[model samples]
Target: MDTEKVTDRKVELEKEDGHALHKRLSQVDPEMAAKLHPHDKRKVARSLQVFEETGISHSEFLHRQHSEEGGGPLGGPLKFPNLCILWLHADQTGPGPSVPPVYGLEVSDVSKWEESVLEPALEIVQSFIQGHKPVAAPVKMPCNEMENKRSYHMCDLCDRIIIGDREWAAHIKSKSHLHQLKKRRRLDSDAVTAIENQSISPDCDKELKEKGSPEQNEKELKSSV
Candidate 1:
């Protein structure tokens, strides 16, 4: 629980509470998509711990937009190149990168949409998984017959949230947000190994370095070899 080893330059947390709270808020924590405005120092420290482990601003990363399509703010796709690539596990699936595909489902008026629709869907899925009973095909979308199937815009990066136009444009310009984009661009940079920041903490940095954008590495390998 000792944070004396962490650097202060990486973050400068606001300390306005008592000594206990000051000690707690000393570290940079996850904003959970920047949703909860916490006052407790310990909570801030724990949040920072989660952020460091994931390299994600936990609280800040939550509920990106009022739009429910992807619950939090969206940061489109990978914008960088890959440097070090260990393609030893080339599967028959075309020797390609193992980036998982995302499906951004935009349901119109999702917030007001009845849980009746979702609950039954999950029940059927669970029933199938548990081998409970022989059920027919499955439930249908109650609003399927509605005329205007609302169309939605999806954010590319993180692929989690669907966002409104105004928020989308602003997100593209945020410092932390844009820097993430730059990192994607260098995923395949042939100039250096990704280990330059190897000493960076093991939490969030690990995943960021390992899977920042392995796709870039695959493209580079295919072209060079």
Candidate 2:
């Protein structure tokens, strides 16, 4: 085949490969597959390409997709107020004379909406589509049941060795540990107060004195003389 023909053939094969990957992805995670730019063949191919590079089976890849380690699906059932519409100016007039106008779009507002608002909305939409209400708490895989060999660190307050660096860090910053620390401080403060209340009199003599019988004292004085 001519170089040009060979190049065209390669491109055709790549497109076929991407479409096949998309078909599988649609069955496993339709929503995730939908997020790709359908018009951009290269972008569509990239997702499956990365998975292939991992050298794992397709089933294992799908398992990881929904795992916490994978960051799970981008959707859930948590609803959030529409920020862009909510923050839209009710009146599009220039800032009032009494109220100085803040010029330009609030980049922070846009960022907050993107980072926080969108996820919950997606989750809520997902739940509705899935024909279920959002779960209050996701069922977690126990540390003991996990396949990875993780290092553990001791949490003094919890008195347990939490498996994995992330778990240990979370435990130390957890409300349970914080509450225990607060209780410990209160107990220590009360003990100090009790000691203060029961302290020895301030006027009590601190000077040292020798104890001796009368004869011993007299003999010492005569010897000194």
Candidate 3:
């Protein structure tokens, strides 16, 4: 319905430690890691994600990105031209035609992504999704004036402390946490979905699962996305 619909699926994950990105970038490409731009924070974080997930150089990934863009038969032109440019910019579109990214790996935009920024960001993102301990938390608003201030406990999800009596009551009786508990309780419920057990999700697994008993019954979970 909105831009968030498209974007929210991919979390803007960040790590807790401030320099996690730098460390990850160094692992991906030490030379480029040294020159990352301060402003292009998200790109840096993505570089870290790519490296952590695939253990490849960001440059190699970009090269692969270029190669995969055109949707060429081998290394030639794309199958569909009109959809390539307009992107079929519609609601019901599946994935549209494959096209190359616009970035040229030759110049200024090169060192824009750094690991220093990415690692921490990634830590934050992982912590958010997994609900674990964050290396760093967002800064709180400054207390002022009387300083006696308000009294309320922080929310378990976002950690923002309740400010008023009404908020305090609501926080203590949060239905959202109840929903989370309910979801947790349904982790193995038949109606509840399941994901691959890592080794159980490859093509071999997919094929065997599609054929055999107990495996096919697993139902493959399709796309937890």
> In terms of TM-score, which candidate is strongest?
3
lDDT of each: 0.43, 0.50, 0.49
Segments in model 3 whose C-alpha atoms lie over 4 Å from true places: 1-13, 31-35, 68-80, 83-225
Which should have the higher lDDT, number 1 or number 3? 3
Superior candidate under TM-score, 2 versus 3: 3
RMSD, one per candidate, in order? 26.7, 22.5, 30.1
Q: Going through the candidates in order, what is the number of backbone clashes in each?
A: 52, 4, 18
Positional deviation of 88 in candidate 3, in angstroms? 18
User: Cα lDDT for residue 34, model 2?
Assistant: 55
TM-score of each: 0.18, 0.25, 0.26
The better-scoring model by TM-score among 1 and 3 is 3
Expressed as tens digits, the lDDT of each residue in 84-162 for candidate 2 is: 1112223343321212112222234665875454665556456656766643223221233332224435667666545
